[model samples]
Target: MLATRLTALLGIRHPIVQGGMSWASSNAELALAVSEAGGLGVIAAGPMYPDDLRAAIARVRAGTRQPFAVNVPLYNKRAAEFLDIVLETGVPVIIASQGGPKAHIGRFKEAGVTWIQVTANPLHARKAEDAGVDAVIAVGGEAGGHPGPDEVGTLVLVRATVNAVTVPVIGAGGIADGAGIAAMLALGASGAQLGTRFLLTPESGLHAAYKDLVLNAGIGDTAIVGRGRSPIRMVKNAFSAEYEAAANRGADDAELDALFARSSLRQAAKDGDVAQGKVEAGQSAGLIDKLEPAGELVERLAREAEAALSGAASCIR
Candidate 1:
């Protein structure tokens, strides 16, 4: 089995972790599938109600004896409630994002839960490590959803975070396959987390139209809306085009904010409004052409990563 510090800490056979994409992983199916395949599966608590989150956790527990995580964005209105549920449900791991971990990490540690903080840069990674996080997942600008406002590429950002922190680091953002995961490991990250790759899986909760659009996207097809504000990397569509036009014309923050508020990931993921909604996806969409079962994909990724690492080692001689 391919192993690393992350695999040992999380009790998984492989060091791969599925990114907890909202709407995409709001259900337990995808998380359960990945966990059963010996990867760390994360159920996103971002868009779920308290009861729904509990139910999702229960469903995953009932489906597999393997470990799984719940991603709780600390900036959400119900963040405290979500944390409560995570603690009460006895979840094995907590992948936290969008806020400082100093206040919350203590309790999770006390509960014997693994706390993996999501940081966007070296500074944040250092801060997370100082706050007692067991590990940190460094997200770069190429990631979908909120990929920080700095726009640093995954290679530079992940390597920077690895050098900045003493804890194990999981490199995220723009990773779509085994080669990418191997690259992260080579850069000193213990593992890699993939969002877009898992989002295109058959078990993802996105609308068919949303998946189709992402599946057809190219490497340069994604656009970043909101440069100074909280930014998101999504597939280029009408909504992004409109936003880009407004920004190009020097639209003020208020104007851009209003335009941004008009569309939502829920609109595209839930209603199939691919043309006018936030079809959130990463640059990795260009690398994925087909939808695979989450379980099978996890196994394939592990095998591919092993082969990639072995092949790269041959070059040393």
Candidate 2:
């Protein structure tokens, strides 16, 4: 039921993908578990330098033989260095986000690596398709971190991207279960990508406190902050509140720099400061219930999608 060009191209048994969360989602353990479980797992390259990325890639290799991907933030100053490391490591896939895919298409093609670009708008999706990338992942406003200002929902984005291009489209933002996956495929997406859902998995490197926050969150608990310049969607907390206020007041670079000088996202992830630390999570946080193994999570999602599809067919008949 999960069969699609995306899955076939990625060589994964399931069409589920784990969105790369920079500081929190790059751990090798979780990446390997997702890959071994039949989904394409992506390692976040945001917080790492070239050497660090190489080490992390090596760690993933140690855990599983299945193919996995590395995410490269195009806006990063060290993008070229990280890209070079990915090419050198023989990484099979790369997920490009935050910038134009056309900028890196040549490198990906030269390296013979599959490129999956994350886009929020249909226009960007078309651009990625024209650039000859393997696939496009359309993430809606419900996603964590930097969702675009247009902020289309998952259902809308998926359908729009599907209509706009012939390349495979992966649906993201607010997807957590088999029903969501089935719905995405029915809407013409080749696969579904989940972010907040996997944060609660046992293999995830998120702090226990952060994991607890995700488990207890409600539908409206999270809000978008830093909208105009550095828009970021995160769990509602003291830090987010302060950031939002600053952005609202049009805090200049100097003021904003002073405000964030001592604030460390990585430290917060490790220390689990729900109130003072920045927590990146999607609106789907409310839908996730318990912590389970990554493999079991993927299996359940695939089985659920199959059942949902079967049930839908029964209704049609």
Candidate 3:
């Protein structure tokens, strides 16, 4: 009964959407479980080849009949290929991030797919609406992976984007609980998308050590590095320290690329290389303390958000 514009448009019961993490979202179990729990689960199609993406989509479809989405980082070299595979596989929704959706939005609309664009600012939000996107996910600097250069907070970004676009807005970054979802809704967001919160779920494919790091981290433990290149929020470690130091000393883009190229995100997410590889997470890591099933977490989030909203409404009465 926690229906919103997002839930109505996506045909889901709850307005919660799990983020598309690179290595973590490659598998279908988490996505399937979340979708079955009445929230939209997104499979990250960035780190996968065409064949792998197709297989992942098939696995989720076979596991659950509920609606799910495929997130394609528009900047990825194989993004178009992944989109083709998703369309061919008959996926119902598409979430595009990290680049402009103008070129691909038309194709997704033509395929009768629900196209959602991820934006870091109002400018991008307006652009997405102009491109015919059904919705826009406003991501703030508190987000994991590559955040936008504006470095705006989620609360303010959500409201600004909502005013700039006619499409439904989903707030993302630093949101880990029912309180956060309620706050976003109050800010005019129709839904909330959480990457860091979902990363620690039991169904997530992330390594136990990485999850432990996330669980142990505090609110300010995350640091944004490589501003000139791609601003990324991750748990502080020896690897990040070195990377940050290099960037601070005026490292060129090539140098930054070389530094980052030394290790892959999968190395940390799958193999648990806490010291060397990057553990991309958001400021929301501070809110996660335990691991639970994706389905249970989804249900809990919905119930908690409902109760919180009801309590707030009772204050006026």
Candidate 4:
């Protein structure tokens, strides 16, 4: 039993949490499977409307009796509405990202909901702590979607955040296996969060082509694109190249809009267009080899972490 503050707080058997992915990780089947496997599953609430989010939450609850979290981007215009829907659904945990007012944190506290905030640096972690968050998730540049500057890796970021805040730290970015989870715990994190690993799981709703890319990608195959405007890590392709070139050439707002308009993120995720769509994934893609059930993935990670920790102990003696 890998007990930690997070495991005890969330009532999970493992100290691993699934990172929320905008379009891919929000699916009900994957979320339920992760929870059933004894890890916390987070439903990505950013890309869905209020009704859709409620429905997804219902679906997850219907599938698993275990607790789960809903990730809401604080920067979204509809964040308040989404929060209301989440509260209405009686979801126990809500993860807020992208910075929100302190009053929002207080609101969640008043509602008796556990609030977690994601930070890319220690400064954000400190801010989240000050805002009364129950925990902070520190994501490094190796993460997918919008990562901060590439100067800090997950190890450094997690350690720094742990030092800066009294709240529990959930380490993210480039973590896929039990070895990674063990390392995070050793580094003072209460838990580990993963996104890329779950994207390749059979329960994920991502297109087969996208899943294949994750399974086949090697180390360094994932690149950070649009560093200045919308820094995102993804598999390199013609669409990414075009977007990067346009950003480099100083394309104006209209030009950039046209360039971005040509590519569709949802279409790519749903239709499997490797060449013309935006596929957000982390550098951890190299570690994923196959699409298995989410429950199997979670169970295997726990066993692997236990074995790794035991091996380390034996070596020390």
TM-score of each: 0.99, 0.93, 0.96, 0.94
Pairwise TM-score winner, candidates 2 and 3: 3
List where candidate 1 sits over 4 angstroms from the true fold: none
The TM-score obtained by model 3 is 0.96
Model 2 spans > 4 angstroms off: 243-264
RMSD of each: 0.7, 2.1, 1.4, 1.8
**lDDT computed for candidate 2:** 0.85
lDDT tens string, model 4, 1-317?
79999988788899989888877876677788999889999898888878888888999998888989999988888888988887889888898888653868777788888998888899878988887889989998788878876548898999999999998899999899999999899899999999999888888878888888768888688777666456678888888888878878888878776776777667678899978887788888888777878899999999988988888788884
Cα lDDT, all candidates: 0.94, 0.85, 0.89, 0.85
The clash count of every prediction, one per candidate, is 0, 0, 0, 0
Across 1-317, the per-residue lDDT of candidate 3 in tens digits comes to 78899999999999999999997887788899999999999999888788888888899999888999999988899987888887899999999888888777777788899999999999888988988999999998899887888899998899999999988999999999998999899998999998999998888888998889988999999988767666688899888999989878888889889997886678789889988878899999988889878999999999989988998899995
Q: Give the Cα-based TM-score of candidate 1 against the true structure.
A: 0.99
**Candidate 1 Cα lDDT to native:** 0.94
Error of 1 at 71 (Å): 0.2
The window of 10 residues in a row where model 4 has the poorest summed lDDT is 223-232
Between prediction 1 and prediction 4, the one with superior lDDT is 1
The prediction achieving the highest TM-score against the true structure is: 1
Q: Residue 2 of model 3: what lDDT? A: 82
Error of 4 at 294 (Å): 0.3
Residues 1-317 of candidate 1: C-alpha lDDT, one tens digit per residue = 78899999999999999999999999999999999999999999999999999999999999999999999999999999999999999999999999999988888889999999999889999988888999999998889888977889999999999999989999999999999999999999999999999999999999999999999999999999877887899999999999999999999989999999999999999999999999988999999999999999999999999999999999996
Model 2 superposed RMSD (Cα)? 2.1
State the local distance difference test value for candidate 4: 0.85
Model 3 weakest 10-residue run by lDDT: 224-233
